[model samples]
Target: MEEMLTEAACRLGVRGAQVAVLVGGELREAATGIANAELGTPMDARTLMQIGSTTKLHTAVLVMSLVDEGLLDLDEPVVRHLPELRLSDQAATASVTARHLLSMTSGIDNGFYDDPADYLATLSRMEMLFAPGDGYSYSNASTVVSGALVARLTGLSWDEALRRRVFEPLGLRDCTTLWDELPYHRVAVGHAPDGSVVRPWTFSRASGPAGSTLCSTAGDLARFGELFVRGGAGVLSAEACAAMHVPQVSLPTRRFAREWCLGPYRRDFGGTAVFGHSGTNYGGSSTLLWAPSTGVVVGVVCNTPHAGYPLAAEVAAEVLGAAPYDVEPVTRLTADAEPYVGRYAACDLRYEVSAVDGVLTVTLEEVASGRVSPPVALLPLERDRFLPERDLSGGRGWDLAFVVRQGRAVRLVSGGFAARRMA
Candidate 1:
């Protein structure tokens, strides 16, 4: 397993990685390379890897605990608990429920904000992608709002509530939401695609509940996954946990998961529905996948930003004999990629898609900083969905689906967010 970890991470250009596999009540652990390539710190069990938005699972579980206590209701409008809350859409402001937020069905776009005040203040003027529960779009803003809801109802900060509810209940020792606690622990800093360290290491704190501050060791993360595998393990009722794995909304592509659950991702493993989640920050990523049918859970931590997909995926593949990213080979291009050639906007990033030599190419431009990413080829995997051929970053594949309106394409949907055509 150690050899496999070293070989795969090295092959993928990753500097450091740690993995934990839980199968049939036995847990296996392995680590490879350097945790901080810059400092030459070796990866170990103590090295805490930022799980990014995979922290959403923790928040979701925390919120579900609130539901179990009769402190919150998933179907209730969010404004009922926090009357001051308001969205850019008037109808949505009164109607958007907690279910929409956790399920990633909220229309709120991912925006940078300072705190809850700035988040709500900015969202009040911003337009959403669609009506609440009408479409699926990953929203850090929505999760932040739900985090605020957690704070409001619990009379405690989001950090305090999560620790008391989810973290402590599962007996997870090497996990935390506090940034100051990082200095005392073995931590893995992020490295950019150029192999440079990710400075600042953190993004918007307002989105912390959406996974900005969450960090954990691979074994500890696997233990958290085990809680769900145990059917909530007394912290959450089996029924409540079951609800979280229930499909709230379907995705545009099945290359990953066919649908989005209340908090975790819902996918099929050997015909049995399984739940898991993945998260990526600027230069680091992690994944916690649970295959309940097989009584297996895979937790992987990596210091490379794009490592979330294939790193966790590769480890899981080694354990389970196959992973989700191993797609059926697209031997020949059958779909027309020309109609999708246009500019599309997704939150802070804008994409410029053009056909070079009649092949679809995507160039990413950051709206806030005006940074442009190198153009990459998008190969057709299915009808309107295409897979990104890995570039220098070693980032793995994600399905990019074009949404057509009228007779032309109007949006490029990838991951969970839709990049609306801006050209």
Candidate 2:
């Protein structure tokens, strides 16, 4: 396992990497490369590496634990708990529920924030991309708000609440919400594509609940994954555990399974059902995969941006004895494609749909940068749904699904956020 990880990291130009696998009730671990390139620190089992959004799983677990205690209800509105919660859309601010936040369907705009203390204020000033529960849009603000709700309900800071509810319970001594919080000397530093160091080594504390600021070793992550494979025994109720893994909303990407649960992305590999989450940060990527039937959990982390998935997938395939699935082919465009060709806007993004040469394509424009992504071909999936011929976000495939109203497309839903049609 160590050799495989080392080879994968070296081949991919990853500065540092770690792998931990749990099989047959035993935990096996391996590490290779440097933790800190300047200091020439070698990677090891105890080295702390940022897990990014995989921190969502821990936050979800904490929320579910509260649900188990009957102190919170998933269906309750966010405003019900945090009455001060407000968004640019008053209705959505009042209507959004905990479930919506957990399912990534809160419809709130995803904004750029740098301070943990500013999360609530940032959310208050943000506008809704769509109505709550209207569609799936992955928003960091939604998860950070969820963390704030947890803090309010527990009367503790988000970090302290996590420590009391999750870390201590799971005996995750090495896991922490921030890199600077790590007591250990061995910590992986992120490196950009050009091999330059990504300084600061951590995201703002405000984004900790959203995946910007959590750090852990591969072995610790594997142990966390193992709890799910075992049905959430000591941490969450069986029912709560099942709920977290069940598909709550359909995802827009083909790189992952079509559906996402409360925390992890759900998918089937080689007919084996798997649930886990992946994380990406400044110059690091991490993945945690678990197959219940095989009782196998695989965790992989790397200190280079977007380089962790291949290694993690390799480990998962080897453990489950499965090969990678082929990409879904594009289908013929339908006659009803006219209704879907239009302009849609959400937050700082604009989408223009058009048909040329009897083929349909969508162009995405970033409002701030005025930078337009290459027009991506859309393959018909259903009457109002289509899959991009290529993954829109590099290796992660994002699909397009139109929301129709009064027999005409009124919105474009993809990448977990809805874009309203602009007339």
Candidate 3:
């Protein structure tokens, strides 16, 4: 299995990758690639990596724990608990409940620029993109507001609430919310694909609730996955764990990935439903997944900012497919060649999907934002499967791809973008 993973990493040109398989509480660590591409630090079990939006799972766990204690209600308006929050849409603001935020159906647009000055104000300024519960749009503003709600209800900072309810009890010594908030030595420095170290600037702190501060080692993350696979014994109740698996929204179609639960993006890998979330920051990426029925969990931590799914998927497939556990990869079929071909843009986000000379090409609207490059070009890798050019971000050369289901692109598999188009 180690050799297989090493070969995959070499093929993908992953600079630093760590894979940990947790079976029935036992763990196996397989690592290849350099943790520090410059000084030649090999990734191992103890090395910490940023687990971006996967941090939302932990936040969701904390919210569920509060619900379990009768201190919070999922159906109640979040504003009822935290009266200070005022959305620009008065009606949605009054009606939006905690559940709406968690499910990413808050009708809010994603407008989080990497500007600290606009962070707090942006949440209240963006108009409700749709009515609450109308559709699912992955909104950073939605989650950050959730963090604020938790803080308001508990009368504690989100970090303190997380510590009291999660980290300490789970014995996750290395896990933390804000990496910079922690002592400098313990946090892993994020890196570009070329091995140049990159630290989060002022803009990073603004992305708090959605994909903010989470730092952990593969060992610690495996332990986290184990708790979920084992029915959330020490952390949350079985009922709470069950709620986490309920499907709240149908994701865009993708061939390589599975569907999504309320919060976690899931896939049927090796005959078991692998429940987990993939995360990406500017220069780091991580994933934590587990199969409860099989008692198999997998954790992959990487330093180069955007290499989560491939590492996690490869590890889970190898360890979970040991024996007796067998499942077929669902072959995705697509036929709609019209609805998918269009130029779509909302606010600062832009992309165009069109059939050019019998081939479908999706181009990013580069002239608009003018970041590192334009929207990524995705070339078909298989039937309904496509792989993006690595180093597309100039330095973060993660060769990720996507699957088109029906006419919508599902999970952003390669880039770790957690967006699904609305119907």
Candidate 4:
């Protein structure tokens, strides 16, 4: 395991990595490389690394606990708990429910706000990408709202609720929603692609519920994963636990993921059903995968962005005796893509489509950063449906589907978000 970890870290040019694998009711851990590249600190089992969006799982469990206690309803409109909830779309603001937030189908525009209050305030000024629960769009604001709901219903802060409800019950002593809350010495420093250190180790507190902040050791995360395998042993009812694993929305274009459940992303690994979550912050990446049939849970953390996926994949293959199933190949069709060539905008994201030498290509731009990603060639899968040659960031499947109206592309849908064509 250590050899595999070392190889993966080296291959990805990561400074360090830590992994925990649970099998046959026994937990095994391995660590390799430096926790702090400058200080030459070694990463170990106790090293705390940011788990990123994986924190969503913890938040989901907290909500489930409330549901178990009859304090919350999954289908209740969020405004019922926080009547002040306001959005640019008043109807969506009133109609959005807890179930939509948990399932990432709220259709609220995604943004990173400094605090939960700020998120809600900004949401109130933004229009919905789609009607509430009309489509799947991963929104950090939605999770922040969910966390706020938890706070309101439990009479506790999101952090406090997590501590009292999740960390304490699951015995995750080394986990925390805030970076500063962790002991400085035990925390693993994050590093950029160039190996430079990243400051402000955590995202803003407002993003905590949506997976912006949460630092924990691999071992601590494995213990949390065990809860799912054990069917909610102490914290959640079996029914609630089952609900967390059940598929809530289909995500066909996502690489390995088949659906988004209450919290975790669901996928199939070598014919065995596996559910888990992956998280990435500025300079670090982490993943937690568990298969109930085999009782195997794998948790991996790396101090470099995008390094955890390959490492976690290797670990999963070793434990499951087979790799993740291959993504279905997109069948290219013979169709003219000229009508689809145009610029599309949605919230902070922009899409530029063009055709050159009879080949169609698409590039996504971040409006705020003015950063345009490299153009990816799009192959026609149907008249208006296409698939990117490669996967987009955020595990969004390579599939790109267009909504055409009056012989012009109206919207480009991919990565669970829709970008309307700019006139």
Candidate 5:
């Protein structure tokens, strides 16, 4: 396992990483690379790496624990418990529920935030992407608010609640949301694509619920994953544990998954379904996956940013002994193609889907940098979905999907976010 870990990290240009896998009734572990590239500090089992948004799973478990205790209702409007929550869309602010937020359908803009301390206040200046429960847009804004609600209802700060209910109860030795404590732990710093240390470390404390500040070793994460794998491990109710993996909403894009649960997104590989969440910080990425069928739980934390998926995916396949599942491509268009062609923008990033003489293509652009990518041909797929013939950056393709309203694609959802159509 250590040999495989080191080989994968070296192959992927990862500087530091840790992994923990639970199989049958035994747990195995591995670590490779450096905790600090400059100091060349060796990564180890005790070295903590930012779990990134995988923290959302812990947060969701915390939220679900409330449901088990009868302190919160999943379907009840979140505002019912925390009225101070407000969005630019008053109705959505009022109507969004714990279910919607946890399921990524709250319509809150996963807006850019400057300060974690202003997490809730930042909402007042932001707008909703869609109506509550109307569609899915991965929103950190929604999760932070959920954390705030947890604080309100538990009469404990979100971190405190997690420590008291989860970390303490599960006997997780090294997991924390507080950044000040990182100095005392063997924590991994992040590295950018160029292999340079990431500046400003992290922008996670304020987005704790959305998974920015949490850090842990691979073993601690795997143990927490046991909650889902083993009927909540008696920490949370069996019913609530089951509900978190059940599809609450589906993403039409292959970029994520076909569906999302209360916490993690669900995907199938080698015909076996696995539920887990992947998270990315400034320069790191991580994933925690558990397969109920095999009773296998895998946790991967990589300090090398932006490319953690391949590491996690490879590690999971190695542990699950999964085989490749080939998917036949859809060559024929099944839906009206006209409504899908449009220009969409999220801040300075742009995507333009166009049809020229019957050949459909998408042009990606970084408007702020005045850089435009070569057009990539798009093959038609079912239900208004499009498979990029190749990635905009010239890598393998990821399928794309749109949110259509009144006969037009209102947004292009791919590459981890939904870009609003620019009319």
Candidate 6:
């Protein structure tokens, strides 16, 4: 495992990494490379790493908690909770729901590029590409709205709500929403790939719901995963936990590394469906995935900005596979996977595929030169498989699959991979 972490970091060009794997309620910790690669500080268990979008799982739990309390409805409109969110277009404002925001179909583009101040208003001003709940485009603005809704429902700050409802009950003392307020004596400063200490940006407290105000060690996160594995640890009821894992929408990469149930958890790992969240913040990456079937929870945190959340996924994939359980491979055919074999025009490349050895191997051709080169081969595994060819050193794979529609494969999913099987 130590060698695996070192190799992963080196492949990602990351200077340092820390990974924690939970198996059957026991955790195994490993650190490789350096935390401050130039300063000679080694990555360790206590290193304070960021868990970016993984925060969504936390917020989702909070949302479900509110549902358990009858304070919010998963199907309710956002305007019912946050009337202040007036979009530039009134029609969109009228139709968008809390579900729209939670599921990332709010029609707002990723808003991180805009100044934090303008985030909400800018999102409001943007025209809806499709009606709410009609399609999916991941937007931080949606999660931010979720944070705001939680605050409004509880009449407390997001940080306070999370602490009183989650951290305190879970005994996650190391976790806090206020990263800027963290005591510098114990916290490790974040670094870029080149080893320069990154200037900490003030995460928009208003937008923090989407990606802000959370910090903790792998140990603390493991405990949080345990709570969910234990059906919300009396914080929420068993029924509610089950509801959280219910499929709220059909997503492309819905099941990667694990299945995308309602909340951030995957269903049926080694036959156990664990419920938990995965997060990545600027300059940090994290993953807290567990398998209830085996009672194992893995929580990983890495401090390097570019270490990326995919590292957590790499860890999860490895951990789950290593568990001592039998996963009966479901035999599904790839015969319908032929149509996806044509050219996909992206910004700069043409994606093409050809059948190889009864499987699909993808090739990204540089369009200008028409030079074809091999990419990681994506094989069919009961209708889906991981990107067998990504530069796994940084740890991100789409785990793509061929979506069969109308008795034929029609689309290739992102995060979850799919390609047309061409002759």
lDDT values of the candidates?
0.80, 0.79, 0.64, 0.79, 0.81, 0.63
Clashes of each: 0, 4, 10, 1, 2, 24
**Tens digits of lDDT, candidate 4, 193-240:** 778788876657678887777888888888899999988978999999
RMSD of every candidate to native, in Å, equals 2.8, 2.7, 5.3, 2.7, 2.7, 6.4
lDDT (Cα, tens digit) per residue for candidate 1, span 1-423 = 889999998888788888898876688899888888789898897789888888888889888989999999899899999888878788998999999999988777775644454566778766677788877778888888889899999999999998888878878889888989888888989987667788887876777888888889888889888878888988899999889878888787666577998899887665666688888875468888887777888898888886557767777767776545436536334356668988888667788888766578888887778988888777777767777775422454557777776768866777667766678
Query: What is the TM-score of candidate 2?
Result: 0.89
Stretches of candidate 1 off by over 4 Å are 113-117, 270-272, 325-343, 352-363, 372-378, 388-394, 405-410, 421-423
In angstroms, give how far residue 108 of model 1 lies from its true place. 1.1
True-vs-predicted CA distance for residue 137, candidate 1, Å: 1.0
**Winner by lDDT between candidate 3 and candidate 2:** 2
Task: Write down the lDDT that model 6 would get.
Answer: 0.63
Candidate 6, superposed: residue stretches over 4 Å from native: 1-13, 22-28, 88-91, 105-107, 193-206, 253-259, 265-276, 322-395, 399-423
| Predicted structure with the largest lDDT when compared to the true one | 5
- lDDT by residue for model 6 over 1-423, one digit each (tens)? 878777777777666667776655576777665656447777677766666677777787788788899887777677877777876567777778766666666654445433465446666554444457655545666777777788889999777888899888878766667865577524555667676766664355555666665766777778777766688787788987777666555555434434345456454545556556665555577777776667778887777766656566567667777422223323323454465565543222346655654456666665457886766566454444434445422345345544455655443444522222222
The CA lDDT at 383 in model 3 is: 43
Q: TM-score of every model?
A: 0.90, 0.89, 0.79, 0.91, 0.91, 0.72
| Runs in model 4 lying further than 4 Å from the true structure | 113-117, 327-340, 380-423
Across 1-423, the per-residue lDDT of candidate 3 in tens digits comes to 679778876665567677777786677887666666556666766666677777787777878787887888888888877676677788987899878877776776665656464454665765566678765566667777777777777888888898888888888786777655556533455666455777652247656666766777777778787878777767888888888788776533343234445566666764667778767775567878787787877787776664455555566566777312212223222244344555544445445655644445556644355752444445544444444533443333333333455655542333333333333
- Per-residue accuracy of model 5 over 111-164 as CA lDDT, tens digit each: 664564667877877656778988888888888878988899899999899989
Q: What is the lDDT of residue 244 in candidate 5?
A: 91
Residue 105 local lDDT, model 3: 69
* 2 against 5, candidate with superior TM-score: 5
